[model samples]
Target chain A: GAGVSQSPSNKVTEKGKDVELRCDPISGHTALYWYRQSLGQGLEFLIYFQGNSAPDKSGLPSDRFSAERTGGSVSTLTIQRTQQEDSAVYLCASSLDSLPADTQYFGPGTRLTVL
Target chain B: AQSVSQHNHHVILSEAASLELGCNYSYGGTVNLFWYVQYPGQHLQLLLKYFSGDPLVKGIKGFEAEFIKSKFSFNLRKPSVQWSDTAEYFCAVKQALSQGNLIFGKGTKLSVKP
Candidate 1:
């Protein structure tokens, strides 16, 4: 089966610019998640989506972080006014559903370099 | 808030040496435990999981983990590590039936020398 996929493996942008990272989850996966990993840091939960309900936006660090899942298959994480601190690998993961035990499959990630 | 903790920031061992990576999670309610591994230049992949079952669970590439509820620990173990085992290991926990949010620990980097 095809695994989760992310577009633009690497992106280098200027500070205060906006970037959109895309994720294509495995087919039929109903749960998608976005997480950020800063330098030498752990995976920081960002947002989550299940089916069609409102996504869980708790982990978004600031108002500039936003995400959307369209057609229940693809997701895009947008970082507005990118800061140097936002330089990190943006990861996308998906599972069968939002259940507590669904094993998540991760994509290679988009490494954003905010210069 | 819930969190996952990985004991060693880094572990280095020679080939055939036994390996153990400690993980502890803080969440009072029911939860699911997972161990993920990321080889150099690779994405994260699930090593094993503890949902509901016998505490001892085995995973890919001759890896196993023991879930000790009393200690709130799920430690990854391998009888003998190969040089190819070098990678970053992560421990993660999901609040039981959560909104699909996962709390991950700072990864433990492992270096296995052949």
Candidate 2:
């Protein structure tokens, strides 16, 4: 079975520029999540989507961060006016269902660097 | 606010040595516990998870974790570690039966010497 996959494993961009990261969840997965990992820090919850609808997006740091899923399969995380602090690894995960206990399969992640 | 804590930032051991990593959560209600491992240049992978049932749960690659509700802890352990076991380990928790977003602790890096 194909695992969750992310595109542009690494991205380097200038400050104030906008960037988009893509994630493809496994087939039949109904739950998708986005998280960010800063250098030497823990993974920070960003947003979540259940079958193309996001019910909880409180973890988003600010209005600059936004994510959306389409057809319950692919998701895109967008950061507007990137700042130096926004440089981090963006991770995506998906589960068979939206249950809290369902194991999440993670993607390789997109490392974004803001210069 | 709910949060997960990993006490050890890094651990170094020789091959075949016993390994233990401590994790604690601050949530007061029922929660799901998980341990994830990321080897060098690899995506994060599930090592084990605890939702309900026995406190002691075994996972892939001979790993096991003990979930102690009283102490609000879920600690990962391995009888023996090989060089291949070197990786970054993360502890995560989420409120049971609620939204599926996870709160993760700062990962602990394990370095093994063969």
Top candidate by DockQ: 2
Task: Please give, for residues B23-110, the per-residue lDDT of candidate 2 as tens digits.
Answer: 9999999999999999999999999999999999999999999999999999999999999999999999989979679999999999
Write one digit per residue (lDDT tens) for candidate 2, span A1-115. 9999999999999999999999999999999999999999999999999998999999899999999888778999999999999999999999999898999999999999999
Model-by-model DockQ, in order: 0.87, 0.90
Model 1 spans > 4 angstroms off:
none
TM agreement with the true structure for every prediction: 0.98, 0.99
CA-lDDT, candidates in order: 0.92, 0.96
Residues A1-115, model 1: lDDT tens digits: 9999999899999999999999999999999999999987899999899965546788999999988888998998999999999999999999999888889999999999999
Pairs of colliding residues, candidate 1 = none
